[model samples]
Target: MVRAEILAVAVVAMFAGPGGAQSMDKATDCGYQAEVVAAVQQARKDRVGERQVQQHVAEKATWPENYNNAIPLIAGWLYGSDVSMRDIRNEDFAAAWKELCLQQ
Candidate 1:
């Protein structure tokens, strides 16, 4: 429940701009965003600490290098205090995030 609220806020913030309508037209961008979410989920499942998530992801990054810039931001949310590692490991957060992103 808490994770859902956080995800909502994050998605809303991402689209909070005058050009948000234009951005929504490019749903392809969310594909990479989803990939980032998946990677972070894997990191959590692998027992990687939030402090090491950035480096850990960079080391085994499969997503495009351009998307590397978003690792820190996504990592913060996945590893934030409000979210538990258990939630990440047990839930399909990457899929949920992608669905929400596409719905925009």
Candidate 2:
């Protein structure tokens, strides 16, 4: 379970984009990478908006520290799927992204 969580976190972080250092503190505080990833997946499926994604991210605030390293992979997948930050905000993309990273 732990390993899977790490992988998920890695994958989500890969596509989460740059500028993650600023969020390290929050990621540590949240401490639940799986929850984050699940939220992102749900957000994408729900066709969420960017502002919502920002709000969701803000709610967790600390996801970057745990998943930032995987942003490239996550971004590639999201880009391939036409899931933009704007669209993701409306859903749980932020949480899902963290969950995905936990898998790695």
Candidate 3:
């Protein structure tokens, strides 16, 4: 029940990014935003540890091969970071993931 609710919220976040981010070429340019949204919600799921969320994303996220590379970083950002999910505004996360790509 809870999982379903979170998944729904994740879907809303993906499409309803601030100021209609879906129109931008930079945001979700590679189509991994769905994966990111799902992973973010999964990372926050009740009683589901980060390890499980990481593993789930690693296996399930399908996009540029970088998904496996980015999932851990995404998981870390969503789970272990100081930025609360409530505080993270739309399309902000794409920049964070882009930073990881820049490092690699």
Candidate No. with top TM-score: 1
Global CA lDDT computed for model 3: 0.50
Error of 2 at 81 (Å): 2.1
Off by over 4 Å in 2: 1-31, 50-52, 60-79, 82-104
Per-residue lDDT tens digits of candidate 3, residues 1-104? 23323433444344346543456454353346445645665556544577787676666666544435445545665665665556444345544444432232
Q: Which of the two, 1 or 2, has more lDDT?
A: 1
Worst 10 residues of 1 by lDDT: 17-26
**Candidates sorted on TM-score, descending:** 1, 3, 2
Cα-based lDDT at residue 24, candidate 1: 42
Which residue pairs in candidate 3 collide?
none
TM-score of 1: 0.70
How many steric clashes between backbone atoms does each model show? Answer: 0, 56, 0
Report how far residue 103 has shifted in candidate 2, in Å: 7.7
TM-score (all chains, Cα) for each model? 0.70, 0.32, 0.43
- Predicted structure with the largest lDDT when compared to the true one: 1
Ranked candidates, highest lDDT first: 1, 3, 2
Question: What shift in Å separates residue 48 of candidate 2 from its native position after superposition?
Answer: 1.1
